[model samples]
Target: MNILLYTWLGSYTDDDIERHIRGMGINCRRIEDTQVCNGDRYHNDEFCRSFEKILEDADYDCVFTTNFLPLIARVCYKKDIPYIAWSYDSPPNLASLEEMDHPTNHIFFFSKDDVEDYRSQGLDTVWHMPLAVDTDKWDAIKTAGRDIDVSLVGRLYSSTLPVLMSRMSAEQQQFFKTLTDLQLKTYDRNILKEFITDGIAQEICRTYEADEDATLRPTRKQLLYSASTYVSHLDRLLLLRVLSKKFDTHLYSTDTEADYKSMLPNVKFHGPVSYEKGMPEVFKSSKVNLCPIFRENVSGIPLRILDVCGCGSFVLSSFCPEVAEYFREGKEAVMYRSAEEAFEKVEYYLKHGDERESIARGGYERVKADFSYDDRIRRMLTQAGVLKK
Candidate 1:
């Protein structure tokens, strides 16, 4: 079967997906649909004209992308071609969620919570799928020895809470902090919505209106989004502060929302590393890689954790129930509930080299067997009805 792959700015996932589709003996045609990708998310006349022509002329079996796009789904729905999207983003994009119910679209979410949520709303197109890694690439990466003790490779996000706090009554600020603390402690799911009532949301909305600066207006959803991001930032900071005091902790990222450089005095802050060249080495070379999952994520396995395991490296990550489905705790991976557990595990695992190596090897084997890019592509295709079972 011939497939058309639509993509935008280079995601780390697209190339691997295309390669694997071809490996399955399927003709995968890629179109960089950056025109519509850059334009209106709902409708783009120029791209609609261009995309229609291509699909009609090529008569491709299905259209695929690394992440779900509403624009693509709408076009495919009209043209009568299947559109498949494998989401890597935890909750996927909020805008994309609305278009998921289109009959022609098969939208796969890495997060089970997303599928359950949309499905609860009776979205038939939603399906649960986990993120995958190109194991072959990671397995080949050679690192001399494990030197880095503890590390986190993603951002220390900036939160609007700080700015919002300036305007809120002291009680409101405390309420906001309480929400973050409660969300952080409730590891199984993101319960931000439960506590964020309409009254509270209205209060926040009114506060933004009173802002002296014209640029301070943010919608209720935006405020909630910020709250989620802030809590995640706090979660990462909590662990980083505690762990860095004891272990040789390092954070490698392109940028930061907070002043992690100054804030994390004990932790070393190396600027960004390319995913292809430097990331795998960091994974394999570290005695323990820290994956403080984004607070918004529910049961989806973050690609970072899988990538760490793909490198045959040990990981100490924030708690997520789905991780246990594929990996044996204390054998293939380590999951921690609180900041204390995370700190304690790092202390224990650092000194135990043999156990760490064994777990790493097991993790690599597990991902290679179940979560390889090839397997994920094949599964996605079969489920999307692109490939014959």
Candidate 2:
């Protein structure tokens, strides 16, 4: 079978995914030209025409990508070629979910919640498949002998909620503040949607500066995103701050914020590390790799968590329903429900070297057995009917 593997920049698994596809004895044609990944995303008339031309020129049995590309979906639907998309991110950027119901389109999401949402609406084209890892590649990298204690390697998103909050009076501000605190304590779902009514939306809009967006009512999703972004920010901030005080914490991100310096006084902040070279070593060398997932990603296990485990490292992450479901909790990995619990867990794991290493080995074995990229790609292709002769 022949496949056209499309890719975009900033995705972590394009190259390794291609390797796995080819490793399955399939002819995989990789497309990373500026036209596809760098050019028009979706809904551009001329761009769509150009993409159709490219697709027509390179005729293949199927087209695959790291995430769903609506432009490809529409073109593939018209051309009658199967298009398979496996999402690594939760709430995948649903750029124009046009032609979503096409028989030739098989959209896979890592999050069961998202799959349920779409499938519940009678959309059978969607499937729930958790993210996979290329353990062989990570296993090849050499470790640096557990130099770091606790580490988090990602961006620290600053929320826009403060901007909206700035527009409100003290009373309204207090209400939203309390709501945020309560919402932060909650898990798995976006609690902001429950309270952001149309009247409240109007009040927020009234206070919101017209120059910013001129819109009257903020959508529930918009409010959820703002609050979630801030919540994610606070989540990571709190985790790192607490962990730093007790352990030799390190952060490998582009977060140069002044507040982070004062907040995490004992933490070491290093520059961003690439997904390929630097990360595996960091993961192997770190005693406890921190993975505080963005709360907006409701149920999907983030790719970073898989990568960390794939590298044979111990990860102490926030409580993700899917993570707990897939791996053995105390045996393969450790899950913490709250910041206080996270600190306590880290404290225990750091002192107990043998237990920590045993958990890491178990996690590595579990990931290798159940989360191999080669097996996942084959499963996706088979289900999509691309491999049906």
lDDT of 1 by residue, 224-307 (tens): 778889988888888899999988998888764356667778888888888987998888889999998888777889999999
Model 2, range 79-138, lDDT digits (tens) per residue? 898999988877766644566888898999999888986887678899988888888898
Best candidate, TM-score: 1
In terms of lDDT, the poorest run of 10 residues in model 2 is: 209-218
Candidate 1 accuracy as TM-score = 0.94
Q: After aligning candidate 2 to the native by TM-score, how far in Å is the CA of 177 from where it should be?
A: 2.0
lDDT value, residue 232 of candidate 1? 88
| Model 2 alpha-carbon miss at residue 118, Å | 2.1
lDDT of 2 at 167: 68
Clashing pairs in 1: none
Per-residue lDDT value at 381 in model 2: 86
